[model samples]
Target: MLGSLLIANRGEIARRIIRTCRRLGIRTVAVYSEADAQAPFVREADQAVAIGPAPASESYLVGAKILEAALQSGAQAIHPGYGFLSENADFAEAVTAAGLIWVGPPPSSIRAMGLKDAAKKLMAEAGVPVTPGYMGDDQSEATLLAEAERIGFPVLIKAVAGGGGKGMRKVDAAKDFAAALTSCRREAKASFGDDHVLLETYATRPRHIEVQVFADSHGNAVHLYERDCSLQRRHQKVIEEAPAPGMTDEVREAVCQAAVRAALAVGYVGAGTIEFIADTTDGLKADRIWFMEMNTRLQVEHPVTEAITSQDLVEWQLRVASGEPLPLTQAEIPRRGHAIEARLYAENPHTGFLPSIGRLDHFRTPSDIRLDSAVEEGGVVTPFYDPMISKLIVHGPTRQAAAAKLAAACRAVEVYPVKTNAGFLARCLADPDFLSGAVDTGFIGERLASLLPPAEPSERVLQAAANEMVRRAGVPPALTGFRVNADPSFRVPLDHEGTRYTAQISPGAQPSALHVVVSGRDFIVFEDGEPYVLTLPRVEAGPEGSDGDGGVESSMPGLIIEVMVAVGDTVSKGAPLLVLEAMKMEHTLTAPFDGVVASLSVKKGDRVAEHVLLVKLDPSEVK
Candidate 1:
């Protein structure tokens, strides 16, 4: 085995790799960007190296800098965890040429599956069941339109080298084809440096199922069963599970065999995943499955596979990279119980899932389950990388039990200051269709309303906040605001997400408890249970010409990527004014009302903090 290894990534995955290396007695070196200097992974490493600045393009994605760090740290191997340069074929080759063990598949295999168009052709030749798509080399718009016509309506336009929902569009009609194609190509070029796309028949109800396959230099490959990743939003997976629900014996055998064949065909080494889109229009069956794509590195959802198999996949990757054969034969690898994993992200579900960045004032996870995370209570989430905070995995004897446990776990999560998808994930787990296993890729969209319920703060939560505020103010009980009928009563108003709620508090049965009602919802409150709610003093509306009348402030801290307006441009409400890039995504700032731009304070390529004024508008009075 390699004596020392360098992790060419950051966040939880880097920490995850470091943990395994420590278990195997391998000294691990961690590389970090300026934004990640204080990251948990960097502190946990045996040695650390600073690559470059915060931006991925300048740091994590810079193959030369990462290689330099690895060599300088005396790391004998480089493990490119999941993102950034993990799937870059040239990086893998360069690592090998530098006399360092690359803890990943061969560069040839990565190249073989790098582009969707080429990989589809290869999969077809390898006897794997591939989706019927136009993978031809013709780049003409006319040819693409013709191919879409031939494939039928509702075809998918997917970028040849894109993943994670980038550069993908679904066209529902012929009239929308051209505009969709143009937009897709623009995004594809921006994301992958390739405007190439392929047309494929869109599955009516698809379940994303992938088989984990690992191979060794000895040409031995074995499948580690499958994971069902049907729950998704915007083509990004939200939840995943092992041993796909309702999977039959025959279907499992066929899919597992096909995944092994695909790995062997590429002469693959180390860990990889063969993703298939199974048409569940009827139900999961062998013939209904078709090849989607092959992730040429360890997957983010590998924990579900590990939970069921009781095998450390990272250890397997190291063993294979060290020239060891398959740890277990095809028959020897056993699948046990059911496992589910939910990706916790620093995003607000109410505002179109906008990425949230701030300090995690109180971050806690259930002690019973497995949590792979890099954040602490006082940690800060910046706008430099993916906003994923942690992954919560649970295992139970059956699928229902696992689902129940996971739902409870989601509710038990306590994240403060920065918003998270914990409540949203809990709603998904408790969804009726989800519980019945009748899920598809479109489940979240179809049930978005129920999933993101109205934020009606409970009476208890409001009273707790009011009580805390009173205690903090050192206000005497007899001095409660405008006492009624010789009794102490207080009305506390709190602002959350731009909405205000009034909490009516009075003395209750005990000194610690309080009788509280929030927005007419009644309940009793004590000091324990549910997390403390942040209470902000209500802001009284000022005159129309007062401060902040027309000031447009940034919702989050980010870099200004594009500015679309000038100092004197007249604009209507909701006109796109600028674009801010934050947490690896773009958010468009728009005009709040009909106004003329009186002053512009920012320009393209400028970094702004949250609540920073970007533009001031001179508003026109309305009738």
Candidate 2:
């Protein structure tokens, strides 16, 4: 076994690797950027090194700095935990060249599967079933358009080097293909530095099914079953589970065997995943499942696999890298129970899932289940990297039980200041379609309205707030003058998101069981995993602007990518004004109403902070 290892990543995954290393008696070294200097992972490691500034380009992505850090810390191996340089073939080769063990697949395997276009060709030649698509080398727009037309409508435009749902778009018709292609290529170039793309036929009911495969230097490979990651939003997975709900033994055998073959074909070693897009129109059939791409490193959703298989994957990776044979054969690996994992992100579901960045003034998750968190209470969620705050994993005797437990765990979450998707995840887990196992990639989009938390607080929540308020005021039950004909109650005027409501509080009423946190004058009540902020009415004056003011402000800190309108430009309501890139996603700000652009304050390539005014407009007088 490797004596010492360096984790070339940060956040939960880094901490996760450190945990396994500690159990195995392997000394661990952590490398962090300025932004993560005080992060939990850095403090937990036996040795630490500062790489560079906050931006990934200057820190995490700099391979030279990481290699130097490894040399300085005397780390014998480098483990690139999932993202950053995890799949960078050059980085893997560099680690080996420096005489340090690379705890990942061989560079050759990474290169073979790095690009979607080339990987598809290799899979097809190896007799592995692949999705129908165009992977040709013609870079002309005309050629892409022709391919889209030939393949029919509802085609998917995917970047050659894309992962994590970046650089991907789904076009439903011919008229939208060109614009979609342009957006896809631009994002691809920004994300992967490769604007090349390929086309695939979008399935009617797509389910993302992936099998975890491991290989050793002794030319032995085995499979660890499969996981279902179909519950997605904008092509990104929201929930994942092991032993897919509808998977049969026969189908599971077929997929797992195919995954092992793919690993052997690439001379793969260490942990990797083979993602397949399954058409579930008639249930999970081996024939309907086709290879999408290969992830050459550990996945973000590996916890679900670990929960069911009763194995530590990071230990396997280290053992294989240390020249050991497979720890367990395919038949020996056990699959015991159902497991589910939900990614808790620092983003607001009410605001189109825009990434939220701020201090975690109050943070608490259920203690019964496993939680891999990136930030702690009082820690700041900077806008420099992925917004995932933590991952909640639960295991149970059955899928239904696991889902029920996970839903309750989500509802028990109490986070304030920084918004999260806890409520959204709870709703998704409890939805009827999800509970019935009739889910697809488009499930969230189809039932979004029902899943979103209600705009206004319920009567129960208001009563809880009022009760808490009364308790805080130190008012006793006897203080309320005894009434002869009615229950003694007092009205409490409260404001919630600009709306005022009067809650009648009775000193003798039953105290609410709902969890409530007090932040100064604001009362944050958690109901069904949603946080409702209620405060006493203020006597301050209101802002002097109306909707007609047409002032546009940045929703979050981001870089301006495109400005579609200019000063004096006439635009209608909902017209795209500019594009802002934040948290690795693009958001287009639109006009609130029909108006003429009165002023512009930002340009392309300019970085702006949250709530900074970027544009102003004058309402159209003719209207």
Candidate 3:
């Protein structure tokens, strides 16, 4: 085992790796950027080192800075947790050259699977089932167009160099293929510094199933069953589970063998995942599955695998990197129960799932389940990293029980000030189709209307807000909330989510609480359960707050990555005006109605706060 190790990552993943190292008596070092100086991971580490500023380019992504931190901390090994440098082959080589143990697979394996086109060819040559795609070296526009036609309509143009759905697009017709390819290449170049892409046949109803494979330096490899990550939105996974709900024994055995074969072919070491796209239009079968790609490090969804197998995967990575053999053979590893993981993100599902940034006034989750979180009460959720606030992991004797438990936990979550997708996750778990295991990649999109219902503040919530206001004023109970001489039945004015409400709070069975009756529903207020924090509408008094004048505003705090309109340029209604990068996702703001661009206030590469005026159509008159 490593005497001391430095985690070359940040956030929850770094904390996760540190947890295992501590249990194994291995000293841990943490590297942080300026933005994360006060983060919890830094406090948990045995030693901490400041790498660079907040931007990832100057911080986590810099291999030299990470190496320096490792050396200064006397770390014998470096664990690339997952994101930033985990799959960077050159970084892995650099670490080994520095005489430090790289707690990941060999550099050769990473290089083999770094590019999607080349990796598919390699997998095919090694007898693993690969998707039919164009892996040719030609990069000309003519060649790509012909390949897309050959692959048939509804082809997927994906960047060969990166993952996380960054440089991927689906074109359903030949006319859209050219534009999609161009946009995909541009995003790919910006994200991975590679403009190359591959065309593959798009599965109509795809289920993302991946097999977890482990290998050691002793040339032995084994598979740890599979995880179904079909619940996705915008190509990013939302929920994942082990022992796929509808998997059969025969199909499971075949997929596991194929995964083991792929790992051995690359002489893979440590923990890795072989992801496949299952065409479940018919249903899961051995022949219907094809290799999509391979993640060359521990995945964000590895906790579900751990919950089911009752084995610590990070401990396996450490032992394997320290020259140990496989801890358990394929036959000896046991799968006792079902486990499911939901990615709880700091975003508002009611508002197109736009990422939210601010301080978490109240952040709480269930204590019974396994919650891999990084934030606490009063912590700030910056717009620099991924928006995932935490992951809620639960286990049960059966899939049904696990799903129910996960849904309950999500409902129990209490997050304030910053909005979240907790309610959406709870609805997903409670959906009948999801509960019955009839799910696919398109599930969220198909059932989005029902999942994101209109927000209606309950009477209890209104009463709580009104009561809190009175309590803050310290008014006597007899004189509270428009009370009369003797009657307690009175109307209390309150505001929440941009609307005003006059809650009628009367005396309750318990004098400590209030009874609010509205729309024939009786709601008893309490101090526990769902919080009722009133969000009074802000009344701005400057140019930024001007309304009813065709002034385009930024709805969130983010960086303006692309400005589509120039000053005095005419744009139509609903036309995209600019793209804002926030919380690790891009949001395109559009013109509210047809108008001319009279003035433009922001340009590309500018950081903006919420409600900042970006453009004003009637600027000449207003000024």
lDDT of 3 at 3: 96
**How would you encode candidate 3's per-residue C-alpha lDDT over 440-545 as one tens digit per residue?**
9999999999987346667666766555444443434443223134355444544555566666645441233532212111222322223344532222212333
Total backbone clashes of model 1? Answer: 0
Query: After superposing candidate 2, which stretches have Cα over 4 Å from the reference?
Result: 482-487, 538-623
Candidate models: Cα lDDT each = 0.83, 0.89, 0.83
User: Candidate 1's residue-wise lDDT over 1-623, tens digit each?
Assistant: 87999999999999899889999999999999999889899999999999999999999999999999998889999999998999999999999999999999999999999998888888889999998879888978889989999999889999999898899999998889999999999999999999999998999998999999999999799999999999998989999999899899999999999999999888899999999998899999898899999999999999999999999999999999999898899889989999999999999887899999998866778899999997988899999899999999999999999999999888878776678888889889998899999999999999998888456666666656566555544445444422235335556556544566766656551333532222221122311112334434322112211155777766434578999999888988778888866433466777777888888999999876545578787886432
Q: For every model in order, what is the number of clashing pairs? A: 0, 0, 0
Window of ten residues with lowest summed lDDT in model 1:
537-546
Best by TM-score: 2
- Give the top-scoring candidate (lDDT): 2
Error of 1 at 67 (Å): 1.3
After aligning candidate 2 to the native by TM-score, how far in Å is the CA of 266 from where it should be?
0.7
